[model samples]
Target: MRSYTADYVIVGAGTAGCVLANRLTEDPNIKVILVEAGERDRHPFIHVPAGFVRLLDHPTVTWRYHTQADAETSGRAILFPRGRGLGGSSAINGLLYVRPFAEDIDSWEQSGANGWNFGNCLPFYRRSETWTEGSSPQRGTHGPIQVSRVENPPEICGAVVQAAQKAGLQFVDDPNSDTRGPSIWYYQQTRDGRRRSSAARGYLRPAMGRSNLTVVTGLQVSRLEMNGTHVSGINGTTSADIPVQIRATREVILSAGVIGTPRLLEMSGIGDKDVLDNAGIKTRIALPGVGNNLQDHYVVRLGYRVRGAGTANERSHGLALAREMMRYVVSGTGVLTYSAAIVGGFAQTRLATRPDVQFVIAPGSFVAGRIGVLESEPGVSCGVWQMRPQSRGHVHLTSSEITAAPTIAPSYLSTELDRNTMVEGLKIGRRIFAQPEVARYIVDETVPGRQAETDEALLQYVRDNGSTVYHAVGTCRMGDDAMSVVDSEMRVRGTTGLRIVDGSVMPSITSTNTNATVLMLAERAADMIRLPMAEHAASTYSKESV
Candidate 1:
């Protein structure tokens, strides 16, 4: 076996891993090795702002895992694509840069994640991004990630923004900073001009030259090397099936994301006893919450046929596409720079007191039940989902083999509140589309047409069509509860020299796109791990190897 040693071994060079690798390696003496199961983020499309559509199901860049068929989803197995390269999902995600509500961060402390409240987390959130609008009391000025407004939005998206205001929603200047009530606004993206500002580009790229940081791709970490209650390192095979062992002298950080993190723990015999037994793996530590509390935003889309204006469908093909490419090359503008959604915002349904539903409006439509493939005809679409879903699920292993896909059951729309919220959220979508500003551009509703107007009809439509927004979180949740997998400092419970810093550590799903929140989580985690012994918990944050 080929063996290597590092002060810290961070698995999964995704958003969280990229941040951790960059931050921890700041100390010249702290040798860090970042391992990724996928290839390097060198794909040309991975940098284009609009290329995410192509990257979603791409063979090498995504894992392409599918969720288990459940009653809540009309017994359909949904395609769940996860990023596989250095930047992980951030390289393939919609470049929307959105921060969660203060309440969302505060809820972590309420759930036993002490010191993780918004007040404590704000600095980290601010430290990760440089907004185009410059610095303010709530926004960051100089950070690694570059966040800017969606340039030259199409008329259809503007109409949606106007219609949303006409429908009684307030238009906010900066949605990320302001958290008042229901509001509509133009979306911002994680882009430095025309290129996507992924975590690999923002954080990892800057740290690559440092001798202390070693990034190894195409190595899938199968299991942790355990020394009693402490983790020593990890063992895995390269893409060519060559076995490799990376020993972490100080700490082994798991930043493998929501699905991958729990799967690693279970495979390493550190999860629930029943889960390990079923997977034919002997139990080590009985952390029942290792793979529980899976939360994601299940979205219901409403597609509309356009009347006069041309949408992305027309501009993305033929001579129009050529013009867009040329425009991008010359001025870095046009449809080539667009994100998944040109306009997005928060809104309230009749059943909620606050802005419970979020909207992702695009000037193009996809096939009725899926995304990525735009319709041949000119059209627009709006996808709405409950901002904070109460339903919980689990991700568990079915076999002991590391290559076998884990069973992901989100149990979407499993609760009455969840079902009701979705139903009403869809109704709110219809209302926004009905407003004269947007209605003038629409010929008619193409999906779940006007016939599906009633609450029962809308609920059925939601069950039949709702899909994931690609924001999976909370599997390896952090809290002080008996079932909690990690502590406030992100150290894995019941295990020394082990920690988890990723979306999986979120006690609850954030209120917006999860990429920004995941970045913030990793930023804070890096601080907790690198801070002086006197400033942090000496037991969890240690400089020397345990």
Candidate 2:
């Protein structure tokens, strides 16, 4: 066995791990070991803005985890693609940077995640952000991550924006300002000019040269070494299956994302007793909440054929690619800079007081059958999903082998409320597209088409078509409750020298994209870990980046 010791051992050099490594190593006195299960973020497409679609179901760069076949989704298994390398999902995500509502964070405080309210966490969000549009009382100015507007948006996106407003959806200056309020606006990018500003680029890249930071990529972490209830170290394998042990003198931080975090805990006998028993693993901690409370946004899409204008579908292939290549090389602007979605926002539905539906509009259309292939015709796509789903699910270990994938059951649309939300959300899409100003460009609704007008037909369409927005959260929930896996500071309940600092710690799903909120979670976690035990109990403002 190859053994090494560090002040802190971080598993998974993902968004949260990058933040933790950057912050923890700031004190040079502390030595850190950052491990990842996949290769480095060196793929050409990983850095390009519009090239992310080429990364789906890719051999590397993505951990394409799929759910079990479900009746709710027409007996088809849904693909739950997650980033795999240095930046993790941030490297492969839509690059659309957004934060949840104050209501979402306030609910965290209310739900027993004390001291995690918007007020306490907003400073971290601001500290990590360096907005291109400058600072506001509500927005951050000088930070690591760059948030900017899409420099060159297609005319089709503008028409859709107007159509949403014309259909009675209000436009808010900042949707995070008031999350419940319905709004439509230009989509923001987590890019700085042409490059995707991932967590690795923002946090890890600068810290890579630090003497205290040691990054070990492509290492498959197996399980934690327990000194009683405390995490003493971690054991894993290198590319050649060479055993490696990393002993942590201080703590072991798990930032292996939602599925990986809980799976690691369970493999180390830290999850539910029954689950461990079934998996043939002896129980050590028996935290039932380790893999419970799985939540994600289930989206329903609507595709429309364009008449007067051409979307990316027309430019995604053929000689058009050469033009975009030259355009991007010349000025770092064009269709090549397009994110997964261009324009979208929150909208109201008949079933809820707040804006329950979220829209992500893209200039090009992609059929479900053709995961990475754009349509041959001129088309645009709009994806709408319920902001908050009442349905709950779980991820559990099914085999004793650490490399074996655990069972993922999202239980999508399990409740009538969730099912209705999808149905009504798609109906709202029809209304927006039907607007006179927006409809003028549309030849017709090509997704569900004119035949699927009734509520039942829409519901059937949702069952057959709705898929994940790739925002999985809430397992290993953070709260003070008995069932909560982690406390307010993200310390694993009943364990010392061990903690979870990823999307898995969310008490409930946020009503927005989870990437920004996950960054905030890590920002707060890093601060808590850096402070003394006394100050850790309080909100210590460590705005080093600010």
Candidate 3:
């Protein structure tokens, strides 16, 4: 096995990994190494905003995982696509730039995530953002990641926004600024014109020129090399069919995301004893919480056919298609430059204190269940998702080998509370479409149709057809509880020189898109690691002089 060493060895080059790599390597004295299981983010589809449908399932860029046959959905297996490239899912996601409410961060602090309240985290969020619109005191001007509003909002999107207002919802200029009640706003995307502003493009690519940082692609980390209780290095296979060991002198950070991080821990004998035993691996820590607490937002799409001369369906096909493609190629401004969902609204399910559901308004049809080509349609589509679900699940190791995929049990709709919330979400969605201005454009409800009236019927429909919004988190949660896998500082419990810095560390799901929060967490984690050392040295000298 080829051996290597660095001050920090970060696993997974996704969103958090890229941010951590950039921040940690800023100090020239600290050498950082990042390992990614997938290849470089070089695919053309990954850059285009509308090309996410293709990149979502591309085996080269995504780890296309499927859940075990779910009991809630008539034993149907669900597809879970996660990014495997330099920018991670940020490169292939829907590109909706949203930060959850200040209350959501306060809830994290209440859940034992100390020093993670809104006030403490706001600065980090601002520090990592470089908004294209303009600089704000609340937003960063020199950050790597780019955040911008859509240049052109489709007519259907505007109608939906107006419909939301007609349905008693407020219109907000920036949803990210105030995330309270139901409010319609233009989507903030990670795009520079038609090109995606993923972490690879934002941070990693710029940091690649640094000699102190080394990035290895196609390196699937199998296990953590441990010496007693201390993590020494990572043992994995290189792209060239060679085994390798990379030692970390200071720390071994796992930025492998929710699924990959937990699986790696299980393979290293740090998971449930029964699971480890079944996989024929001797238990090292017997931590049952290592893979527990899986949470994700489930969405149900509502499609409608519209009557119009100029629409996304009209432009996606025939001669108009060629013209639109030419327009995009020439000026990078067209329907192809925006994400599938151009406008969205965040609202509370009930008369709650915080918003717990989001409505995504797309001018085009999203035919493919998980992520596929949009079907031909002149109508608009709206997807309603319940955020902050009360239900939780687990990820278990199917085998001890790295090549083997894990068994994912999301347990969607497992709780009665979650079911009730989803029913409310559906009701709220229908109300928005029923408004006079928005109602004129709708032809029919293609999804639930007119049959979904009663709450029980909608709940049944949700159990039968609900799908994840691709926001899975809280598996390797950070807290001080006995079941916590990592502490508030992201240090792995019952282990030394080990930490988890990804969405997996989130104790609960955010009220909005997870990418922005994950980036902020990594930014804060980098500072946490650096600030202590600086303070310690200064204190040591003062004490010695005294």
Candidate 4:
């Protein structure tokens, strides 16, 4: 075995892992090894803001896991694409920068995750990004990640904003500031100039210069190396199938995301006894919550055929695309710099007090039931989803092998409230489109057309058409409960020197895109692990002083 050692071994050089590696290594005395199963973030498309569409399904950069076929989804397994490279999903994700509401994290504290309320987390969120408008109480200015709002959005986006305002939603200058009640706003992108500011670019690259940090890519970790209840390190193999062993003298942190983390735990014999036995592994921790509590934002898209306005579909092909390429090269602007959505908002349905529904508008439309492939005709697409879904699912290893795909069951639209909320959210989308400002575009609802009018019809349409928004979370949930996988400090229960600092540790799925929260969570986790050591050192007196 090719052996290596570090004070901290971090599995998965993803959103959280990158932040942890950067923060921990700042001490210079701390050594961190961040291992990624996928390649480095060298793919050309991974840098461009709009290149996400290409990387979403790219074989090299994404792990195209599919949710198990369920009755709620009309018995069809839905594609769940996760980034596989250094930045993980951050590199392949839509660059929209959204944060969860205060109430979202407060609920985490209420759910036995002590000291995890929004107030305690805001500073870490601020520490993760540099907003375009500079530092403010509500924004960050000196962070590694550079965030900017969409400037001079296409006319269709303006129309959508007007339409949303007409539909009883107030337009906000910064939706990320106060995302409560009904509101519409332009989206901010995780971009530095024309390039996407993935976690690798924001945190890892800057920290790579540190001699204490080591990044090993293309090393697929199979299982943890444990000495009784304490995690020692990890065992894995390189891309060439060369056996490798990494020893962690201090700790082993898992940031392999929602699906990967739990699966890793199970593979390492740290999950439920029944699951471990069935998977042909001996139980180490007997944590039943390792792969349970899976939650994701399920969305249904409404496509429209437009006439008066030019959409990305027109500019994505022929001479127009050539012009866009030139525009991107020269002025660093054009359709090539567009994010997954130009306009997005949050609004309340009858289901909840805060915004129960979220909306995202793109100045282009994709084919029905499939994304990435734009329609030949000019069109617009709006995706709406219930922000807080009650539906939960689980992820389990299909085989004992590390390379085998897990069985993920999202159980989308599995509840009455979820179904009703989705129907209502879809109605809100139609209402926004029906406004004169937007209706003047003379676009007809193409997907679940006007023919699907009743609630039942809309509900049926959602069952057949709804898909993941790529925000899977809450699998290895953190709580002080019996079924909780990790504790408030993100340490695995019944285990020593092991922690999970990713979205999987969330008590529940956030009310918005999870990347921002994941980044903040890592920042906080690093402090939790380091601050105590600093305090202990500071309190110790020298022999002369004593």
TM-score of each: 0.97, 0.96, 0.95, 0.97
Over 1-546, each residue of candidate 3 has an lDDT whose tens digit, in order, gives 778888789999999999989988787777788999998988998998888877766878988888878777667788788998889999899888899888888988898888889999988999888887676757777788888898867666777888889887899998777545768888889887679999999989989898778999988888999998899899999788889888888889999999999999999989889989999888998677898999998887776777752467667777887898999999998878868588888778773566778887787765632235565777677788887888899888878777889988888888877778888888888889898777887787776778877887877777777777889999999888888999999999989999999999999988788989999999999998877555332211010100
| Residue-level lDDT for 191 in candidate 4 | 92
Model 3 residue 264 lDDT score: 94
By TM-score, rank the candidates, best first: 4, 1, 2, 3
Ranking 2 against 3 by TM-score, winner: 2
Q: Which residue pairs does candidate 3 place in steric collision? A: 306-379
User: What is the lDDT for 23 in model 1?
Assistant: 92
What lDDT is reached at residue 469 by model 1? 92
- Give the per-residue lDDT digits (tens) of candidate 1, residues 1-546: 788888789999999999999999887778888999999889989998989989888899999999999987899999888999989999999998888888999999999999989889888889999998879877897888999998777777878888999988898878888865888988889999989999999999999999778888889889999999999999999888889988888899999999999999999999999889999999999999999999999998899999788799889888988999999999999888989888887888777778899999898898884678888889998899899999999999989987899999999999999999988888888888899998988888989888997889988899898889999999999999988999988899999999999999899999899999998999998888887633533222232221
Off by over 4 Å in 3: 351-353, 368-371, 533-546
Better model by lDDT: candidate 1 vs candidate 2: 1
